[model samples]
Target: MDQAALRTLIGQLADDLGWLEQHARTQPLHVAQAAELHYAGALVRNVVGPFLEGHAALPLHVAVVGGAGAGKSTIANMLCGAVLAESNPQAGFTRHPVAYAPASGAVNWPSSLGFLGTMQRLSKPEPSSLDADVYQVRRVSEEAGQFGVLDKFLVWDCPDMTTWAATGYVPRLLEVTALADVIVFVASDERYNDEVPTQFLRLLLRSGKMVVVSLMKMREADAPAFVAHFQREVLDKMPARAVATLTVPHLTPAQVVDPCRNAPVYRVPIVNQIFVLGEPVQAARQRTVRSATSYLMSHQQHLLGVARDDLLALEGWRQRVREGQMEFDNRYRREFLTTERFRRFDEALVRLLELLELPGVGRFASLTMDVLRWPYTWTKKLFASAFARPEASSMPERQVLENGLAGWIDHLRKEAASQTGKHPLWEHVQHGFSAGLGNTIKDRFNESFRGFQLSLGDEVERTARKIYEDLEKNPLALNAIRGGKFTAEVTTILVSGGAILYSGGLALPFVAASLAMAPLSASVIQMLTEFFGSQYVDFHREQTRARQQALVAQHISTPMADWLTSWPTTGGSAYERLQSILGRFPHNLQQMEAAVQAAMM
Candidate 1:
C-alpha cells in the first residue's frame, strides 16, 4: 500500500471502530469490548500510523497514568523534578491530559497530526478543567528540574482510570498514553490492585510502551512488602512484559514541598528505567508501533465481539423465516396444489388425440371409429350428467397464494414482536413487518406468480406435445393403437348388428341381445382406451401436477422465502450496516500490516 492508501485505510478502520464504540450498548460486555475497540483504533491512528509514515515520535514523552488519587500528578512532578503538576489530594482531580515541556527551551509538539484527536493542546494546564476532549502543553519552570535526567523528555500529567468520574476522560488518557514513548504507572499503595488501574497497567504493557511502575506513598517500613505484593498481584499477573517497579516512600512535608531538594531521589529509578528501556528513540517508537499493531491485529475478533449478539439474532431471525416459509409452502400445497385439476393438460390430451388421427388414407377408418365411439361417449355423458360435479373451489389460486403470504408475514411479525432479550435484529424485524413486509413480499410473489403461470402452462403444453411426439416417433405403437381401436369398433358394430338380425328385427329381442353384448364391447373399448388416449392422458396429467409444484416453488416460494429470510441483512438494515462495517476491519488490518512491513524494509 502506498502512503495515501495506507492513510485512507487507517482513517476508515479508525472511523468504523469509533462508530462501534459510540453506539455500544449498556451491557458490560459490550461496553468493555467497545472500549477495547476504541483503544485499538486510537492506537492505530495515534501511534502506528505515524510510526509507519516516518512521522517522528513525540519527543520521548512519559505519561503518568493511574487510578484516582494514585499520585499521578505527584509522579509527574517527580518525573519533571518540579512542582509543576497540581498535587490535589482530592480524587479524580485531573480531567484532561496536560503536557509539560521542558521550560529551558521552546519545545513544540505537533498538534496537526491528530495525536490528540481534536483535543485542543493548550498553552497552559487547567487544574480545574472538566473537559475531556482537550489537553494542554505547559512549560515546566527551569528551576524546578535541577536534575537533568528527564530534561529532554516531555512528561504528561494524565487523568485517572479507576473513578466513575474518569469514565468520560478515559479516552483522553489513552490518547496521551499512545503518544508517550514511556509510561510511568503511579499506583499508590491504597489502589494498586484496583480493577481499572491494574487493567490500565496491563493494557500499557500489551501496547508495548516502556513502563516504569511507581509504587508510591507507602510507609517506609511497609514499602518493601507492598512493592512485592503489588508485583505479585498486578505486574506478575500481567502478560509477559519487562516493566520496572519502584517505590516512592511516603515523603515529609518539606520533601513533598521541595521534591528537588534531595535531588528528587524518587525520580532516579523511574528516569533510569525509562532511559534504559527507551535508549534508542526510533527503536522504542517502532517497538510500540509493532506491538500496538499486533495488538489490534490479534484482537480484531474481540473488537468485533460487539456484533456477536447481532449475528446470533440474525441467524435466529433467518431460522424463523425458514419455518414460516415452510408453513407457506405447506399452505400452498394444501390450498392450491391438491385441488388443481390443471384443465390445460386435458386440452393437451385432446390435442394428442388429434395427433393420433392418421390423416389421408386413414380418414375413412377414423370416421367409422368415431361413429362406433358414439356409444361410449354417450354412456360417459349419461353417467356424468346423472351425478353432480364437485363444486368449483371457493378460492382462486392467486387468492390462496395471497392469503398464505399474508399469513407467513403475520407469523414472522408475531414471532419478532414477541421475542424478548434477543439481539436488536428482532426489534428491527418487528419494525420491518410494521413497515409493510407483507405488502413488499406480496408484490414480489405476485411478480413471480406471473412468471410461474407462464412456465406452468408452457410445461403442460410441452408434456402433452411430448406424448404425441413419442407415439409418432414409434410407428409400431401408433399402428397398434389404431388397430386396437378399429378392432373394438368393428366388434361393437358387428355384435349389435348380428343381435338385431338374429332376433328378426323385433324391438324386444334386439334390445335384450344388445344389452347382453354391452359388457363385452365396453370391456374391449376400455382396453383400447388404455392403448389410445387414457394412458398418455393420465401420465401427462400427473407430470403436469409435478411441473406445477416445481414452478410454484421455484418462482414463488423459493424466491420469496430467500428474500424474506435475508431481508434483515439488506437495504441498510442495522445488521446490514454492522456487517458492512465489520467487513472492512480484516482488510484494513491486513493492508496496514503490509504497509508497516514495507515501511520497515
Candidate 2:
C-alpha cells in the first residue's frame, strides 16, 4: 500500500469524525450515543497512527501480562535469553514493565503520536511499582543468535489485576493490548483456570488478541490432557470467537533456573515454541487483527444508532407542547369571552343614543348634533364608556399573556431537563427548546395581533365614516335641533289640522314623524357602531389566540413528536447523517490496518 494513500485516508477519516463530533454537539439524538461515538473515534485514531508513518517502525510488541506473581518476570527474562530481571521468588517483585528490545540497538520504539487517544508519553525509568499509567522500554543487551526473527520484538511487564486498584489499570491494559500484535497470557499452574484470568481471556478473545498460555508446574504426564481440558472448557467455550491459543509445558523451579539446559529446549520449550518457532504465528497474528477489525465493524452500526435514538425523543417533547396549546385555547375561549366585557356588544351604545331621544338632524347627523352638546357630552361619553368594564379583559395585560405563554414553554423545557440526566444530547435539546419556542411564539403573537388590529381598526373607522356621510345628506330629520316652537307647531298641525289640508302644504305630521325618527336613527347608528366595534375586537382576539395555538401545534409540536417517535426504527436520524459520524472511524481504521500489514511484509 502507498504510504501517502493510507495517510490521506486516515486524515480524511479524522476530518469526517470531527465534523460528526461537532454535529453531535448541536443536534444530538441521544446523549449516550454522542458519548459512545466520541470515544470510538478516539479509539480509531489511537489504532491507526502508528502504521501511517511507514514500516521502519517500532517492533511488534508482545507484553507478558497478568496478575502479580503470575511469573511474568520469569517469562520476560526467559524471552530475552538472559536473566535481565531479579527473580526474587517474591510476589509482585518486579515493579515496572522492563522492555527487552533487539540487541542490535538498530530498532526504534513506535512513534507515540496519535496512540491511545492522546496519552502523555512516559520516559523509560524503572518505577517502584508498575504504575499502570506508564510503560518502560529496555534494550536486550545480548548478542543475536541464529534466529534474527526475534529482533523485531518488545516485552512489557504489566501490573497484576487482582489488586485493589486493578479497575483503573484495566483500561491501561486495553491500551497496550490494542497496540500489541500478540499477547503472552502468563498463568502459573497454581493460578490457571481461575475466575479473573478466565474473564480476562474472554475479554481478549472478544477483542481479537492472540494468546500464548503458559501452564507452569504441571506434571509432565498431565500436561497434554491439561492442555486439552483448557482448550475445551476455556478456549472452545469462547463464543466461537476465539482469537489464538498456545500452551506451555510444566517447568520446575530448578528447570526454570536453567531453562536452556534442563527444560525441553527445541526453540526453548513447547510453550516457547508457539512464540519462537511456530510456522503459523504471523498468520495467527493477522487473523487476530482481522477478527478484531471485524468486531469493530459490526459495532459501527451501533455507534450511529445511539445518535438516532436521541433524535427520536424530540418529537415526543413537541407533542406535549401541542397538547398544552390546545388546552390553553379551550380555557381562553370559554373564560375570557363570557365576561360582560364582551357580552353587551351593541346594547350600551344603543342606550347612550337613547339620551339623545329629543331627536337630531338626519339619521347620521346626530353625531354632529351630539357634539354640539359639548358641556354635557363629556359626561355622556364617560357614562357610555363605563357600561361594560374593559378592565377585566385587559387585567392580565398583553405583556402578561405573552410572558406567561413563554414561561410555560420554558417550564416544559425544565421538565425535560429534570428527566434527562447528565446527557449532552438533552443539553442540546434544552437549548433548542428554549431558543426555538421563545422566538417562534413571540414573533407569531406579535405579527398576528398587529395584522388583526390594523384590519379591525380600519373596518371600525369605515363604519363610522359611512354613518356620518348618510346623516350629512339629510336635514329635515333635525326637528329636535329646531326644538320648542318648531316642535309644538308641527305637533299642533298634526293633531288639529285636517289630513287633506296637512297633506300638500308641508304636511305637518310627515315633518313631525321624520323629526321623531332622527333620535331613533341615531340610536340605530350607535348600535351599529357598538356591535361592529366590539365584534371586530373580539374576532381579532380569537384569531390571535387561534394562530398562536396553531403555531405551537403544527410548526413546533408535530415535527418534534415525529423526530422522537422515529428514533428507534430508523436509527434516529437519516442514514446519511448517522453515517457521516460512523464513517469517520472506519475510513481511518481501514487505512491504518492496510498500512501496518504492508510495513510488516
Candidate 3:
C-alpha cells in the first residue's frame, strides 16, 4: 500500500479496534476469552493509531518483553543506546515499561491521536522510571539518534512476564504490544521458544501485531541457522497470518553496556536499529489487520446471539404464562359463575323472604290477609320452589371454593414449572407456595367485595327481619284494623239482596245487619291481603338481587384476582406477555410455507 492508502486503512482498522474495545468493556465474558479479545483490540489500536494521523512519522514501537533475568532489560539497553534499562540481576527489577524517544527535536513526535485507545501522557522527561507495566516516554540522547531520517522512534523496556507480578502487568505488556507497529519479542538463546513468549507471539499474530524477534546471547556462527530453525519450529507453527518476523543478533555484555565505545552506533546491531528504524512493512500489516477484522466480523453473531437467545427463552416463558391465564379465565367462568352453588344462593334469598310471611302467623292485618290470599301465597311459593336451594350437588361450600382456588393455583404452579424448563429462576417457584398465593389473592378479593356487598346485604336482610318480627307481634285482632271502606259498594249490594230475599218488610233490618257485617269484614280482609301480596313481591325481588350480588362478591371475583396475582410470583414472570407472539410462531411459519407454495403455483 502507498502511504496515503496505508493511512486510510490504518484509520479504518483503528475505528474497528475502538469498537472492539468498547464491546470488550461492556460484554466481558466470565472466561479468559474476554481478556484475550480485549488484548487483541488493544494490539490493533496501538499499531494502527499512529498511521491514521497525518504525520509523516513512523515510530516503530519495539517491546523487549520476557521473564525476569531473561535478558529483557539488556535487550532494552541494547536498543536504547546501551544500558539505558538497568540490567539488574535481581528478579523483578524492571517493574514498568520505559520508552526511549530520539533526543533530536528535529521532527516532532506524533500526538497519540489514533493510538488504538487513549494513552497516558507523562509530564516528566529523560529516562524516567515507571511503575510496572506502565509506559513512560523519554527522549533518546542526541548521540544515539542516527538511524532514522525522521526522529521520533522509541524503544520500550517492558516487564518480565515470568515474574509473579507479571500476571497483573501482562495487560500493560499487551497495551505496549498493541501500540508497537514493530514488537521486538526479546528472549535469550536459552529462554527462546518458551511457552509465555510463544503464547504472546500467538496473541500478536491474532491481533496482526508485527514482530521483530531478538534471540540474545547467541554465537554469531549459529545465529542464522538458529533464526531459520526458530522460524520453522516457532513462527511456522503460528497461524500463517503473522505480519513479519525479524531476528536480532546476540550481543556481548561489553557491546550492550556502552553506546560510544562501540564502532556500531548502538553496538547492539539487531535491537537498536530494528526497534528505532523499523517501518510498518505496510503490505503485511494491512493483510494482518484485514484477516483479524474478518475473523472478528465472522464471530460477531456469536457474541450478539447470547443476548438474543436469552430474550427468546424469556419470551417462550411469557407465552406459556399467557396460555395459563386464558385457561384460568375459561375455568373460572364455567365452573364458578354457572355453578349450582350460585343458583342455590338465589333460592336461599327467596326462602328467607318466604319465612317472613308464614301461613297462619300474620301479626299485621295486611300480612294476615295477604297470607290467606291464594295469588300472593302461590307467587311466593313458586319463587321459592322454582329457584329452590341446590341439592348440595356440586355446590361449592366456602371450603370448596377455597380448595378450588387453591387447586387452581396449584395447577398454575405446575404449568409454570412445566413451562420454565431449565430456566435459572424456575426453582424459586414451587407448588406449596401456591397456598399462600391462593390465600392472599382470595383475601384481597374478599376484602374488595366486603367494602360494597357485605354491608348492603346485611342492612337489607336486617330490615326484612325487623319487618317480619313486627308483623308477627301485631296480628289483626279487630275488623277495624282492616279497611271495609275499600268494598263499601259490594257490602251495600250484598245487604240489599239478603234483605230482599231473607226478610219481609218487618225482618228486612235484621237481614241487612247480618249481611252488611259479614260482607264488610270479608272486603276488609281482601283489601289487606292484596296490599300484603304486592309488598311481598317487591321484597322478594329485592332479596334476589341482593343475594346474587353477595354470591358474586363472596365467591368469584376474589378467587380470580388471587389466582392472577400468584402468576408472576410462581415462576411465570411476565410470561403471558409474549404468549400471542410465541403462539403465533408455528402458525406464522405455516403461513409462510403456504405463501411459498402459492407462489410456486
Q: Find the candidate with the highest TM-score and give its number.
A: 1
Error of 2 at 170 (Å): 3.2
TM-score of 2: 0.55
Off by over 4 Å in 1: 26-29, 104-114, 123-125, 128-132, 141-152, 261-265, 350-394, 451-457, 469-539, 570-573
lDDT of 2: 0.53
- What are the per-residue Cα lDDT tens digits for candidate 3 across 20-56? 3443444334233444645645533553334333344
Better of 1 and 2 by TM-score: 1
Displacement of residue 277 (Cα, Å) in model 2 is 9.1
For 272-377, candidate 1 gives per-residue lDDT tens digits of 7777766677777677778787888887887888887777777787888888878888887788777876676667666666665656788886766655456766
Q: Can you tell me which runs of candidate 3 are displaced by over 4 Å?
A: 1-29, 40-57, 106-119, 125-134, 147-152, 218-233, 241-251, 259-601
TM-score of every prediction relative to native: 0.83, 0.55, 0.47
For candidate 3, the TM-score is 0.47
Per-residue lDDT for 80-182 in model 2, tens only? 6655555656566554445566656565544533455434435655643655455556556556322322455566655556656665555455556666666
Against the unseen true structure, what C-alpha lDDT does each candidate score?
0.75, 0.53, 0.52
